[model samples]
Target: MRRLAVLGGVSIALVAAAACAVSEDVSSPPHEEPEQSIPDADVREVAVGSDAPAPTRGLLCSSDGWCETLLPDPDLVVRDIWPFSDRAFAIAESFTSGIKVLEWTSTDSTWRYIDDNSQNEALAELAVGIWAPSADEVYYAVSPGTIYRGTRPVAPATAWSWSSERLPDNNPANVNHGDATQRRLTLGVWGTGSDDVYAWYSNTIFHRKSEGGGAPAWVPELIADDFDAPDEHIFITGAAGKSPNDVWFAGSRRRGTKEPCDVLVRKTPEGYRRIADGVVPELYSDPCTAREGIPQVVGGPRAWPRKFQSLDGERFFALKSWNNFLRIEPDGDGYSVNIANVPKTLLDAPNLISLWGESEDRLWLGSTFFNSNRGVVVRGSQVWGDGGVYEYSSIALNGAPSNGPPNQIRGTSNTNLWAVGDRYALHKTTP
Candidate 1:
């Protein structure tokens, strides 16, 4: 198998040497630094509204605590939410049909369905990812690697115009194009700006760059082959970045059902390269065989990373397992990995699947399950001097129904946050 060469003049041997010094064993307890002082946790009020609506379907709340059901249809299962200053956009799946795009503006104070009629039902049903940099521009990704771009029309044209394109299909034999059973589904879409956007499926990362001309088309920027993996496939589950020059993709490499190892690659001005692997010594063993005797990495994440989000591009947080997460940041010329546990005391639920934040000090996480009684959302604040420790607190959802957990959490700022999942959507805004 082929391995990536050294990055930015730093050889992989040198990178490994530097990582060994700071890398924590996943099985061991957190190493405390006695010389470092932990910062005091920030305090904020939990506002309760007098006429708050019951969180039966979902709830929207302000900082002072006024809440109401935010979904236009109670049966819609919101998959993701993108909040803006004057409006917000969401993609939700219904019990009877596939996914639908909805919009809510400050002027209207209501959610409106905005998907194009030209989009076929098959593609619509596969829509799972949505990202909007502004009200005028949005990008949606569907299963089996199809992307749709929607743009608001000028005056005299009240409707938005949409164009669709498909990402390269490596395994076209998988006709189902489903995410769970196949590798065709587009996992997520994100970008620093509308002109430079990105979308990724299982093993390929697609890029669309428009340069002062008509519309540009999505093109394959990177693939699993570029990494020279021992296995035929690498599962890329999430993507995030600070800018066009600095983007990150994370996932795992599996030798069939056994011997799974972490895979992390970053894209810089230089190009894309793998920075770290086999992070947990126990799990990072022999990629060629289904070996059983290899020791498991202790204190490391319970599973491979499935999602990632960055607060400052400097520090990226990844959701690996139900109660465990990872903090990846630059270390010298390369990068280092730090595994941290979620404070069980702070979470009422188990599956913390969604992650978002306004800054390094303030972060938010959401839990998920079909029929969870307590839809939990936890806010984490960094404890200074501690290697990536945080003080976590469960945000109170005063009128929220115990119907289901949140699948996603997003916000424009610390005071304005939104969490949507199952059959509900919750919003927190300034009073």
Candidate 2:
């Protein structure tokens, strides 16, 4: 099933449901930075209506920006791509039904499923998220249910065995709250190693440490114990860290009679503590009044900053709805959060599906245009991969054909990127 869309974009239809709209003065700003260059050659006209030429549904392009179809059958919809090593492990759904795992082979330039119909069903199950610390060490979580770990020999060999464990039906986590398929009880899974796996379910986080057993035997532990009480109501969305102790979890809460707010929490050997609240503020605001407002959960599912990832050992990045980009870095014992200035065109887009980066300087953001199949790519860069200052520009997309913006993006480098979504699979091989 497709992962539920995170609420970061401002949809035209959701304007009425907005918490409160107060137009703020857009005159002065906190700090001014150099604006980045836009790749106008890559930007194309929005293909609209039935008369437009059919989009190249499964496209894979090179570093130079030349693209070609990756899948022979246009009916196969690529959902997610986990580019690990020289190979890419992805979840693709065929027209007939079922989300299957597809392994892209660099050797022969082809794609194949991990498990054919006759093999183990555990390998056949669709996963909500995929992560590969290494080619031999890969992990994926099937929402509302289990987490599977797959170890492989290398590419071209599609055969592999997996170890699966059922997620505990613990307290406070309501996996069965909404739609069982689209909105999985489990949001995502990640780890630095097999024994140190972490899974997020609703507002709770579960940890499975290697228990001296062979082949990654995992015993689940309710690691996130210090969540906000029932009064505030916490919802855990995105999580990532360099290690188990050096991790960060992004969540939001609506306190009694108070506005909803998002907070970033960091965990260490000492324990977890609230690092920052109202982390990403509106760009056009008084620095003094920036933290004065709250970020009410707008469109749906937990919202944007709900998703985050570490760009390197020192820096982390996140997104907030209605066009707020965040940059986080280690500052002594805590973290310093900076509100980034995304391209205005991208900020006005309707929906944001995914955010990922190959490095601190080469960041990618995916968003859907208002009422159009076209998605926008905002490639951002900082001053020499270090944080605190940056600039961004949008690359308009063509040939999406109403499938929605690209949902997930992953790459080994900027030139070796892949953006997969509802009905489209785009690849960038060259610079």
Candidate 3:
């Protein structure tokens, strides 16, 4: 749907309905620091390293003879890209019909897939991770009602040698939180650590430490032991693949009462814990009043800091401004955040810019902290590799033709970087 056409309630209901299962809240040790001691998180990032060349994959391409090939028409739509092993990498592709696992030779840039007809369905939204513990990747195929771990490679899919009982199909919007294909599906997903796996499912959150194989074995735990009780509800929002325990979600309800309306968090071994105490006051004020009051207070939980990610699966960070949180310098010695302080003429929501990164360095990208109206793009520092901040229209597969005022950084990783919703909605960096 176009950004202008998305209805807050309807969109939420459409997605929330199918995802109406899971649960949580987060709690932080109170700091003795003064109220003003908390500093903004946007630090102007500097180019840490150089464009340090990417290992060239010499794979030649067969042209579709359609669009401008020179303009960068790498056929395989890359849903997600990350180091598969020390030398190889994998990109998940969910095209028109089925899903595919493209393993890159990194050296030859020539990547192939385990093409099995049954393997074809919908790959996780390109940006979403296609769990590959070893070489065989693991993913849930909702349309076919199966969860595939990686099959024999043939043409365009993993053609996994096996399949399993499908995950419950409670997704309302048919989207995958990982990529456009499953953005709204709200499939069970989580990270235990760079190597562990996590899944926040109905009433329970499952955790496991394993290399991709057959069924996912996990230690069962309650995301919300009392979610059945009135006032408690959990909905996961942002998560990390590097660390499954670093999962984050939103919920509503007071701890002692069933008032049921609050944001929460749940980590490995941790139960559903409240993350926020109260909604920003500006949310209750009239828009007319809010425009003058503060943009940070207008939206609801939508207004409350909606996305969260692990700062390495241990400490967590949030992009909490409602208007437009601009110019982030994660590596900056002191700079943390820069609110709509950017000149408004070139920007839109000073707070809604998209946020994603792999390391505070390259391997990630963040939306423009300034000029969001025109759209902004910030590259990770060279520390990881390519680092520099640039501005580009936040356009990608499964993305709105345009989602100006509301660009989402998604708070995953640049490698985990992907978008869903439209043909152009699902955006990925490498693939």
Model 2: per-residue Cα lDDT over 218-280, one tens digit each: 343323333244443444666787776687776554333344455555566765555544322
What is the C-alpha lDDT profile of model 1 across 1-431, one tens digit per residue?
11222322222221242222112112312223232221211112212112212345544443434244456566777777888987788877776645677787667456777776333443344447689878888887665456777877686766667777655544223222334423322366889887668887666677887547855766566665422334334557778877888888776654444455666667887776665454222334433321132211223443567557786677887776776666666655555555544554544347766777667656676764333545666666562224334443334456445356676788888656777776666656652
Instruction: Report the poorest 10 consecutive residues by lDDT, candidate 3.
Output: 64-73
**Residue 10 displacement in candidate 1 (angstroms):** 28
> What are the lDDT scores of the predictions, listed in order?
0.58, 0.51, 0.33
Query: lDDT of model 1 at residue 379?
Result: 62
Q: Point to the candidate with the largest lDDT.
A: 1
Report RMSD (Å) for each prediction in the order shown. 13.5, 14.9, 15.5
Instruction: State every prediction's TM-score relative to the real structure.
Output: 0.74, 0.67, 0.47
Model 1: weakest 10-residue lDDT segment is: 40-49
- Of candidate 2, the 10-residue stretch with the lowest lDDT total is 40-49
**Model with the higher lDDT, candidate 2 or 3:** 2
Report lDDT (Cα) of residue 55, candidate 1.
41
Query: In candidate 3, residue 422 scores what lDDT?
Result: 17
How close to the true structure is residue 185 of candidate 3, measured as C-alpha lDDT? 27
